[model samples]
Target: MSDKRTVLVVEDEEMLLSAVSMEFEDAGYDVLCAGTAEQAYDLLRARPRVDLLFTDIRLPGQLDGWDLAERARALQPDLPVIYVTGYSNEQPRQVAESVLVMKPYRMSAIIDVARRLGVG
Candidate 1:
């Protein structure tokens, strides 16, 4: 068993997902990538634990980031969540104890939040 903490990153945009995943990886976390909320849900179900969830507000399929966070919280009640979105005007229905970060955020900022959340 590795000591490295894990983070599940959900983003529909392939490039953004890749970039974010790489940043997390570089920051010494076990990075899991999902292109949609459904896929992220599946990963959450399959994995025993995930240290953090960094997701985009807008996503394809039946669930959005808010929906995914709700479902994930059901599975892991204390899971740390960070919601990222390009649309600042979108009214956020965020979960408790979670952070909402706007688009064009610095990777370091995200990593710092994860660390503060006790992830890495």
Candidate 2:
């Protein structure tokens, strides 16, 4: 596997996902993107070296972001996950403790968390 840090961005918004993917790529980290939980799971299963996962709480389909986080954790015990959402109250208790970032966040905040998680 490559030594470069990889981040899996699971988001439903097309523009936001593209922007975030660009940001992370510009910062020199490898990025994997998925629009739904099933896509994310497929990427995870196909690529086992993902270092961090950034997912939004509100997502389409039955799984949603919280479910994705739980399932991702089960698959990769030590994988660090950062949850992003505009709907604060809807976030699950289990995911509340993990790194929760509000939408419209500054790039600095994302970069800081990525660094802390050891992702470039």
Candidate 3:
């Protein structure tokens, strides 16, 4: 077991995922990268502890970020979520202890949000 906080990041865009994962790693978190919601869910089930979920709203599979968060919350009720979307028209359905952030956001700002949500 590690003392570092863990964050599972889901993004279809390879560059974006890498950037976000790197940022979370720089923030002292155990970063898990997934390109789809299904992969994220699998990690959620396999991992005993996941401190945060940072995911893109529009994913490849049937389950989007919102569904992914809901499912994750079912497994880990207190999990914090951060949903990102580039599509201006797309809106997030509310989930407890979660925040929706527009695309092209600052990584530092995300880290701050994670900290506020009780994750290091």
Scored by TM-score, the top model is: 1
Q: Which ranking of candidates, highest lDDT first?
A: 1, 3, 2
Provide the lowest-lDDT 10-residue window in model 2: 89-98
| Clashes, model 3 | 0
Greater TM-score among 2 and 3 belongs to: 3
CA deviation > 4 Å runs, candidate 2: 95-97
Better model by lDDT, 1 or 3? 1
lDDT of 2 by residue, 1-120 (tens): 667789999889999999999988888888999999989988898875788889988888888888898888888888888888888776364543368888889867897898887666
Clashing pairs in 2: none
TM-score against truth, every candidate: 0.97, 0.91, 0.96
What is the C-alpha lDDT profile of model 1 across 31-94, one tens digit per residue? 9999999999999999999999999999999999999999999999999999999897767899
Clash number for every model?
0, 0, 0
- Model 3 CA lDDT for position 28: 94
Return the lDDT, model 1, position 11.
96
lDDT of 3: 0.92
- lDDT scores in order: 0.93, 0.84, 0.92
